[model samples]
Target: MAYNAGMTEIQPSRQVDLAIIGGGAAGVLTAINALRAAAPGQRIALFEPASAVAQGIAYATPWPEHLLNVPAGKMSGFPEQPGDFLDHLLARREAPEATLAEQYVPRLDYADYLQQRLAEAAAASAGTLQVVHDAVVSLQPQSGGHRFQQAEGANWQATQVVLACGNSMRPLPLPAGNALPPGKVVDAWDYDGVRMLAGDQDLAIIGTGLSMADCVVSLLAAGHRGRIHVLSRHALLPLPHAHGGTADFDPQPLLQLPLRARMRQLREHVRIAQAQGLPWQAVMDRIRPLGQALWRSLEEADQRRFLRHVVRYWDVHRHRIAESVHDQLMAVERSGQLQRHRARLDAVLVQDANLQVHGRGTPPFNVGALINATGVETRALGLRNPLLQQLLAEGHARPGPHGLGLDADPDSGQLHDAHGAPQPGLWLVGSLRIGTLWESLAIPELRVQAQQAARAAIA
Candidate 1:
């Protein structure tokens, strides 16, 4: 690896047993698991560009209103130790009550928990675990291992590389030839920037997913009295988790069915559960464990059909909000402070200091600001990350099924080259494997993937 001319003095090339990219939850967990599985003195380097590790875009929020969608009991960093997170909370006196398992804590709290866990893992590794604060820009296959080049021209060689670069926010789907006006539009995750807007400024939020819900909670918490408009193809918000807790149901029988039949079974299950005085969420919870397996069982065409027709509905039901947050959203809706529209955004134009948002089958509307909460871009080819772009361009990796993310082995997470051959020593975890495993995003699935990736890399 060569450094750019006239750049600052480059550091000497470092060697490591494993190199994990991106310091989000996935990366941190992979490092911890790798450290635990590695032999004594095995070097592990985690490359994260941010000043802090494990606080990825999701957990980096400072607002207490941004809470985890999952309950505390299920948010353990280690799958083998299911109560680790709860134990940490108890030890820190953050939530001293033993009954705090069902509590939905702030996302920042989870970030802190993950950071602490990373620190503990580092200490236990006895200087073998190193957190390199730099962005990896490119990767190349070398004679004995892989060479990773950083943004500042530093390079490192590792016998194995785990691509745990999580998710990236999708760019606003603005119409052709229309550029988003600066200062008038913000990413929904920009909590501080969104809160800085005047309370009376009318805001239009694109997409009614979890991020949109978070924005609503943040705006309400900030005492915003603006007329908030939410626009999506189907203006459906996420349902709240059952207050009575999840119920028992069997998803095994439905696993072999096709997409349509499987969905019918799910609907019938929900109906029966509701008639039997159980919340519909119970059925979803039962199916959670089998989500990825069922997804993989589908034919490629059926999988694509599911993505086109069933994904939105599944997401709204599967990923729910906290009951308190749901109540707040309902209160705002009942007070006429919030409005939901079912229309696809077509264009965004700057009309003076305001934004003119055009939608299909609706007249253009003006808003003081627009927030893009359309969620992460799943199509791997469209990502802007230099490393991913280079990897795909050079045939180091290919797009996963349905173009959702990088293509990798479902069991081992070993990356597949453009020609569909598994690339040895190259693994992918977290949301990057969403194409291979439909339920790869959340902690429950990620922890398992982290462990598997570490073991595979070490093997």
Candidate 2:
């Protein structure tokens, strides 16, 4: 297989057997599976605007301080080969601190592992796989398949298309016409910008989620000694993972209760597990696998209520960080370097040389830089992806539950059109399935979806 480094203007008009869009972890995994399962002469195209594949927003961070939230053992790219990621780390002698299965490795090393896996998959496959460096702007349904129009280079058709673009960052929540002060407010997604701030300049991070935790770690790693003000509605930070343990709790019974009752029952289970000398994380781990099933069992109204009131608490307990990171955050808090506020940011005032972050019931605090760590935009209505915009505009696709993502068949990831019809040869994977599957963004779910979508496309 030959990988094209750049897009070319002139090319023969040939439709590919399969086209996997996005080039991130999801797309790369799908391409790998497709390449292995495709016929001898089948051709697959993996489109990524980036120079390389597998370095999506999540894994593109260059800082070693940014570690994978999950353990190395559970971060494998292939489901059948459960130890592939851990094996890769050992083979390259890149396992830092510890060589055990539960070691938390740097996300940069994970990106390298993904790239290597992609290369090996392409090399060993009987089918031809070519990576096209281009952004797909528009995808229109055609007679036999779909036609993809790229921002650069020649447009082409594909027998099947897999939309694997990851989630987009939500815009800063500010009042209409309230523009952010230029250069003073940096998004957390811009790793370089966040890490390059002046060491002594006080900063304010907008959220208290994992992204905020990451920003704090990055700044501390960069030798920053400024006051970091973290603000959120709940003022909650992600909990730390347990050292190592398992809880034999069954989550099926909770599904039979109402949303609030389920939550109550879940808390009871956690209490029981704690009484039995098990960490709360162990109970959460047991429930993690059944998250989607439990989510789908709730009525839409109950689901909305859960989102509005219970999501923050659930997130802090469910998506935990490594014990080391959690400890660092605690040290900073105790040293008066990190301050947490339970409030919402209502406005930002440009005062002299600093930004004044204001929220109801809280006094305005001045900071040299403000970081937007509000997290990904789950709602699909105002998405900035051109292809997604076009799809919704033309009624080619509809939003998923609670308008979080594009609607698709939960089993095969086959996308459904506006009329509730499943579009042939069209599939979706990754965070885009959040509305349909609550546990869609993690590697375990992504690898499974990628494999299933690939097999279905090939079949």
- Whose TM-score is greatest here? 2
Tens-place lDDT per residue, model 1, 219-262, is 88888988998999899998998865565766787878888898
| Candidate 2 lDDT, 1-459, residue by residue in tens | 223355322343357889888998899899889988988878888888888678788888999999899999899999999988888888767545255578888988877888887777777888777777888988988988899888875788999999998968877778988787689888897999999984998999998988998899999999998899999888999999996477886678988889989888888988988999898888888888887898888989999998899888888998889999999999999999999988877998888898888987578898998998989888999689998999999998999989989999988898999987999999999998888887899898999999999999977
- Following a full C-alpha superposition, what root-mean-square deviation does model 2 have from the true structure? 2.3
Which pairs, if any, clash in model 1?
none
Give the lDDT of residue 375 in candidate 2: 90
lDDT of 1: 0.85
User: What are the lDDT scores of the predictions, listed in order?
Assistant: 0.85, 0.86
What's the distance in Å from true for residue 232, model 1?
0.8
List all candidate RMSDs to the true structure: 4.1, 2.3
Candidate 2 regions exceeding 4 Å error are 1-14, 94-99
